[model samples]
Target: MSRYSKGISLLENLLFFWCGLSLILSIGGDNLVIPSWLQVAGRMHPLMLHFPIVLLLLAIALLWMKEESWRGFGKNLLLIGANFTGITVVAGLLLASEDYEGDALAWHKWLGVVSLGFSVFIYFFLDQVANLFRLAGSGLAVLILLTGHFGANLTHGEDFLFGPLMPKEDKMIALEEAEVFRDLVQPIFESKCIACHKEGKIKGELRMDHLEGLQKGGKSGPFILAGNLDESLLIQRIHLPMENEEHMPPKNKLQLTEEEIEILRLWVMSGASFEQKVMELPQEEPLFQLASNKFTTEKTYSFAAADEDEVKELNNFFRKVKPIFPGSPALEVAYFGASTFDASSLSDLKNIKEQVVKINLNRMPLENVDLSFLSDFQNLEEAQLNFTGLKSGQLEGLSKIQSLKSLAVSGNPFGEEGLENLKKLTQLKRLFIWQSGISESGREELKKALSTVQIDFGFDDKGIIYPLNSPKIDFDKVMFQGTTEVKITHPISSVEIRYTLDGTEPDSINSPVYKEAISLTKTSQIRAKAFAKGWIGSEETKTLLFREGMKPKSYKLTDEPHKSYKAKGATTLFDGVKGKANHTSGEWLGYTDSPLEIEIFLEKDQKPKAVELSLLLHEGAYIFPPETVEIWTGNAGTWSKVTIPPTPQSTKTEEIRYGLLAFDLPQGSFDQVKIKLKPIGKLPSWHQGAGSKGWVFVDEIVLN
Candidate 1:
């Protein structure tokens, strides 16, 4: 209390008071129920979560000024600080649990756990259970500095810690004996990052267990920026202001100590890199199995290896990435599917044409492999090989195909000077040149070359989207039944109606033109697609010939009971029914109660007769059964299932609005019509719980 008393300026008093108030109100331990409005705020990225952590660490440090500073007051302050920290941890945990991937976030998690641990220990000390406040406080600051620094690296990359240093400041340390990424970076990360970013609960989806895993990036994308640490997301996150929510290690988790911060900042600024100077990847022997085999099977498309070792590396990398995409259980299918990887003609790709989607072989070995194989997997999306031996010369082989969307050749010796080959690919979407041998001049040259194509190649999130002119239609729906001839209209001139009768996409040849005399009773969903080719159709001016004459086909009642009954049939499970007014018996159903289900079967006697459907009942007798009815005629039916609704809720049932369904009939009498109810949960009724037990009854009926 003395320490607090000494700092008690009006402002300090308010701070402590506010802290105490927060602690007290938050305990509200009385309610067993969690608050419904509970929400924690932070930018979605891991950088945002770091803010509170930095402040919390600093607040905790303030609790250890001196022994005479506050007597037992230090203990109380520590307890309050712990409470705030605990809340922050819980919130952070919640945020961390969201879906994300890549290994960069692995470091962020470790930093958090260390911070959480410090807070937990600090809690014990506050209760007079531990005699190490000074030691613990100092330890907390150090842990914070460590965790915060690493977490930032995982988000911003290596440059964040060590900014660019001139030749004067970089003192080359003696080279070590042996160098292994797992042995080096992994330890620093494990020691500083493994806490929260570990497998089970990584805050930003960053994990640093092994080498290939490093190839997998954080949520923002790859972490290494290939070979250039200066441009990596891992470093940028660390340098952020402590108050900025985007600060790494997350402000809520911990703060970077000045010493640790300085060390890292210097490291990154000096062109942070890890080099044991071992033998370069051999250009001759196959380090990666680039050949496609029957064994490679991962749905992300296909996995290519730079060599046999690279195959194993990709196998591991894919395994790590698989967890990132959930609900896509089929991803493992790649492992079970044919392995399209072989050592011969590494780029033969006869085996992976349509199968592989993502291929990762960063920094692997391979010089000449025809990239022509990339064309086969029209679905090929992501290709990464940073720091690999492949140069821009090989990229030209890939540029021919328009489907290759995301390509990263960063950190490689590939100079953009030879990027002319890429200009032909109008579909080139995301291209990465970070840390590559691509000079500023080369980059500019490549851009100048691609000035004609619509390419989103910038590093920032900003996207330049140019809307192209294309053909379009302006209609909500198309009617296939009664419409013997539909006037297919489009805003674009010289458009054609290429429709498919087999429910396939409409194209020019597979489907005949909708000439002036078009006829369709055989097609259920006849697509009166208006197409001009170059653009997607618009709705306002486009028209699909709708045959409103197409109505619900009254089903033939099975056996019909055939004879007309003297009284109307009605049941009481849900809605109640009265007498049938129209020629059909559809008025005999009561649609109420849960399950909100209603089934109707229709039987007809005549062959080749088309009929429309309708339901009727006495004004006050039957209503609401069809508030929302889902009617389905199994496959082969001429029409799509539909929802039928009643006019309104009231005692008046006679003036019942009609629920009509229409579509071309099969030119023959049908025996049964089955209508199924669904999706809408149990319907609620004021009658069952009200004065008069309201009831709606129904009966299957067909109209001709």
Candidate 2:
């Protein structure tokens, strides 16, 4: 029933102050573009204080408004604020842990603890404080007022505590003139800014590729503002050096020269604002992506920077350093720039690992380079030093690389003698010593010492000249009989070929020499490669195979009455055949459908001729006179078929027909003759597979 007495005016004032402070905090958070370091200090300090302040206020309000009848809720509120005060203290410590040198910060933070204690004490003794409410509330009000004043002074100077703080109107860069940003500004950044500050691919998310990116910086905020160089963070940073935390671009990254720093300051004072138009640097391919395209060029590392001034400066230095082209499979790196090397420049090379395969130390300060540096490049496979001061001692170092495959020391004075130590590089293949200090006699000595290595200075008339030319061989061809043995003959002799008649080149150590009389079946070819010394002859010959003098190993007669079954209804035998089937030329008959297929065994190579082919004919049929006995070479068509002229053969020549004769198309092993026995009349009715008797008897075929 009794409200704590006195001071309604003071309580209303404190409530209004709290309301005002909250409103400014919310609004300022959105519109204010403050220095990043200052803003971080501002936000972090307030955030650390807020929970305790709000909770304590709520706890106080619990007592001011809550009745004792409401029991423990007021006490609970006070306890919650007390627990959170510890958290507030921890956060406050962290915020102050960074660059808070002044004691004002210390005083302000301790005073906050004092106010929190007062709030807690009042909460614990609710009845007594409630009875003296107005007096206690006045003390609380004074505490709050002092805390706010102190915080405001820390952030915006003492005058800021008096009223709503308004900023001076900022003159921003004209929207239309951003392009001026590139020429007047970006070049300065590229030349002196990006090495450590702008490259995002480092410890921080920093990049200096654009104005917008610079505006939204990493680890730091927008470094400049329009027309206020003195107020710009960028200007402030440039004023710092190696020891300062806010140093422009770190000092290890070449600091901006004094004159360059002055340009940046002037640019900032000229509204530090970017023109709407800016010249964008040509988009260079990313070093990593570019190096990955070719097999030999590899990008090992890219140290990207964020500060525009540093990055721009770094680009100049980067362009001068020789790009090392690296290789894969062989995994080597080649330093191809012949520019003079200095200690500092060579020091950069120490960063490159030993995977370097080649280096062009031509026209460089090779004399100053420690030869011991070469020892680390264990995988150096090739090197070229056309013009340099490398001498005998250096050659000794170079010779120690075991993986060296090709080397050229032309135009360098690597001593007056040949590289005696070079014999250690047994894997070396091509060596060029045209302009090195090695004399002709010395080179000859090296050749004798390393005979297998192909050393070249170009063609020499009297010296041991390597014959780059190799002779070509032609394996003529092969043909064989019934079995799968194909006869192959290469016109070029002494050159051995490992051939597989199965169509693969011969690689077996025991590729048999093609012998004569091979039996074969099915379509096949003999593929061979004539190889001699280092000259690998191309596939020298391919032989077209044919089944010749083959006894039927298997067959299913498609026509009836098989023996001496002279073909009938023949438009003309061998009509579409490419060549005229001359009856005078000896040839054998090839079958379309058969009851028996010939499977013969022969020496699986070359060909066999002079076979006596005997057939048992019925001899009781329409006469078959000495028909045209033709020979077919089995060309694409029957181009070469010879005929047999009848002589005074015994009985069956003119009398009864169908009698067997020991016959042959006498020829070489490469020949395939298809004999045709055309019917004198429609075949006699005894034809076998054709369900007719129109055929004569044929059996006991002996191919000798």
Candidate 3:
């Protein structure tokens, strides 16, 4: 045989071998695992796929050519085309083995396989059967086109080419107008599940894009057994662990939120009815509340949309402008970063005043005069001035905004008189006056004047006449050398401050009332509480006082303090000053997700009577007293644990109080003392942030 002929025969044999291997792999693609090194090449199938397309088309064109020279070239072109098609099929199978499945994937796979088979036949036997070659060539062209279309759909998403041409409109309807099944349930399936279970991509042979398909069920049978969520396959798959193989939407797709899952559960449990309106559901039903909150339409205004250029120009880092909703013409303007707020900044929003339906200036540094521009926003429906400087007579211009439907002035010093000006805003529906100077009586009077408006005065204080406020401690240092007098005062002058020095919580009858400064000469744990008529007693405030002794010459910490709250170095522990209730004041050293270990060294050997550590406990902020505190004392290499304090029980309510863990040492001359404090590794179940690491805060450590 000639050298060229031998080379052609070798190439043909190689193509046939590859074509057979590709077909076998494609059949078992779902169970195959491509090696990590080959995975990258497999993923490149999409990028390298165009090569086979061009080669196949070139081979077909060459066959169609009337010229004898081009006809002769068709044989080599078919050989190249068959090899390209075989390799593409193999790459595609490797890519498909990695979690890719469904009807679309199968269709694309088999169609490509068929094209490969046709290419093989045409390459080897084109000369033997002319009519058969033409028929197979035409069939291969159609199969290639169909495979490419399905492949694009699987990679780029369904209807990628035709989706843009369809008319777009808001599919969401108001909760009042939405039906429980058609509007609420169907949309969720379409967004999260239908992509895999639709007609062409019916994974598990289950269809969800239509009601009839859902009723007909899939390979495993009916997804929903009416009125039974536990038996429903749809609910079961959604509730599965995200890492589970049977989990719906897969791990990478958008999973259902707790609320969305509950909505589906409630809908299925309610007989899985297809003709129920949301309003028709029982008012007390949980589904009714979820539907009302999720699907309710926002209030609409008839105002025109603001000029895009003007709105764009008014927006900056400190100022924001946006439409009220998806297709609404009304605009909402808000200001942030109070430090950058200027009085004249409000005037810049004048261009969109006619379209402005809401304005939020909460916590902004704008004065009363800056609010003068509010009168220009005649269409304003809602306004928030919470924590602003604007007070009483300053809101005269706000009264001109008759379209205002809701107003919030919480946390401001706006008194009862300031609220009277808002009575003229007859359109107002809700008012927030919490933390304002407006008292309970003032809120009642305002409610009577505006009979139709709902006035919110924040959470009910349970009608407590005088809710106990934190007591003020007048002593600078609870740990002093000789003696120090500490004075306690309550916020309300009429309330009596009672105290106990034995570490027991104070009571009205048992604890002595404080009349003047109490002088302390020795170490004591002072616990105090406020007592008043018709009110709950204040939280106990504990303080540790120590008689000063030899100061630690140097100290070393096992772990560095967190950078955010590293106080003035290790010496801050011996500074003799107590930190405020606020743990983030830079006075308290905070340790999170780790224990704190400290060793103190004295200038001379001395046997300290006791070692006192002051810690802050504010469970709401994830700050808890150390789970266990181990104290050790020794010289040089040998050390012995003096004591290990028991862990205190976690409290239910959030209370800010000081905790002192005291460890008494035995008679021994020790120069070095070590303290190991372990924090709560995970918060208790009662805590809102359960299963999360708790924080440990230490202000000062006293040695005497």
Candidate 4:
């Protein structure tokens, strides 16, 4: 035999061997133990299969070419394509033994084997079946197309091939009729999860394709803890770092987005109800804003954005005017600092009347005349004038804005006359009259006139006294050289804010009522609450008042913080700005594997009586307070260690908390101080990441 003929014989023998090996592995199914080395080869099936597909297509085209001379070259191409096809079939069988199943995978696997069989058969009989050569080539081409179609579906997701041509179901569910789980939560799973956790391929033995399987769970536990996100196995897996072996979607697949994860959190927080509708929850619920995007078609405005200079000039510390979303032309204007809100605040917004689509004047001292300014905003779709001191017959001024769709007049004393005028706004779809002066009968009359409107007459009193929310405390600065003015405000006009300087809780009658901003000169623990005539008292809110003492001239960290959370370096500790409770807010310096050893130099003449280290506690994220805090005072390289009490145990739950660890110092004049904080070596037994390293996040250090 010729040299080329011998090489061709050897390749054909290898092809036969691969075809048999693929058959045996396919029969082995789940019983086969694929080694690590073989699994790596199997993963190359996706990349290698494409080469054989192109080779076969070209070989088939050459074989059927009208020219006779190319038929000889086509015979050699067919043999080479058939050899690679056999190799691909073997790799595919190995891949199938992994976490792959469902109808799409099954069809793709069988059709791939069939396509390889056809290529091998046609190449051997090319000369014997000359008349049938074209017929067999056509059949093999059809098989390749079908095999590729199913393979694409397996890799890309269901309906990937014909999804664009298929008739789509309308997904725009009305807010009143949208079910929480069916309309919102389930779709999230189908899109991001469910590939490996479906019926046939049950990774971790967990099936998330249906409700019952989710509740039943798999090897770990229940999919969700119902009202608890910390204990839920599914949430725990998702919150794991992307590089973690236990992270969901295997890090290689499409991972869940932040918005999708938030929807899951809302679902679990609201009892993971399967029967709850969107309208059944409170109208002001944060979930409604998220669900609105999913359930209804997003509104688009036709007007162009306002001039950048005009928008920038209008924005002040108290007033904000910006687009509803990024790059959107529609503007949502809001007025803050209610004490400075004047009548001109509404009139000043007319500079961008064409772009102003939403206005929020909630809790402002707005009068009836101020409502007339809204008439010129030709594109206004939403008006939040709740608690604006509007009275009866004032809403008539808003009827002229023909584009108004949502009107929130809640907390106003607008009775039948005010609601009667709202009937003239034919475009109005939602009317918020909660706690307004309108009676039930008057609301019925208006509802009949605007039959399609969704009227939210918030929480029917029904003689039930719901607890008020805690008063919001606003201060210019947390650390101050002189006295700082602390202002406490509540949204409702009738609600009273009572506060105390001591650590004791505030009561309705015993505590001093907050009429104006309170002046503070020293360190004090302030606890405040809200009370109304017919409502239960609100929970007490606590905060610390710090009088700045010796300021640090400079500071340095002996140990580096984690790369991801190293806030502006050591300067963050004495920048005079405190971080929020969220540890990821760039203001915090996070340490995971090392102790925080910081040395600070105070002014020469200043002597601090005590030192406070501000830290965050969020057990859900494995951020715990320091296990031990050591303080040493020194000057000119001479140091004296100060004895400190054992670090107090953290009283935090799943929620984020900002707390201080204060240490009193002995009477001495020390210019240099060293603080050492050791993070928890291992998480507590009750934590989700037990036996793993914990994190310590410190934002600022106060010397008083």
lDDT of 2 by residue, 188-239 (tens): 6766665333321221445555666677655655556777766567787778
Ranking by lDDT: 4, 3, 2, 1
Candidate 1 lDDT by residue in tens digits, 492-513:
4576656544434565566666
Off by over 4 Å in 3: 1-202, 207-227, 235-473, 487-498, 513-517, 529-549, 602-604, 633-643, 649-657, 666-671, 685-692
Question: How far in Å is the alpha carbon of 604 misplaced in model 1?
Answer: 99
Question: Which candidate leads the pack in lDDT?
Answer: 4
Scored by lDDT, model 2 comes in at 0.46
What TM-score would you give candidate 2 relative to the actual structure?
0.21
The best-first sequence of candidates by TM-score reads: 3, 4, 2, 1
lDDT, model 2, position 24:
45
Pairs that collide in candidate 4 are none
RMSD of 4: 13.5
Model 1 ranges off by over 4 Å: 1-64, 67-73, 102-104, 126-131, 164-704
For every candidate structure, what is the RMSD over all alpha carbons to the true structure, in angstroms? 27.6, 33.2, 13.4, 13.5
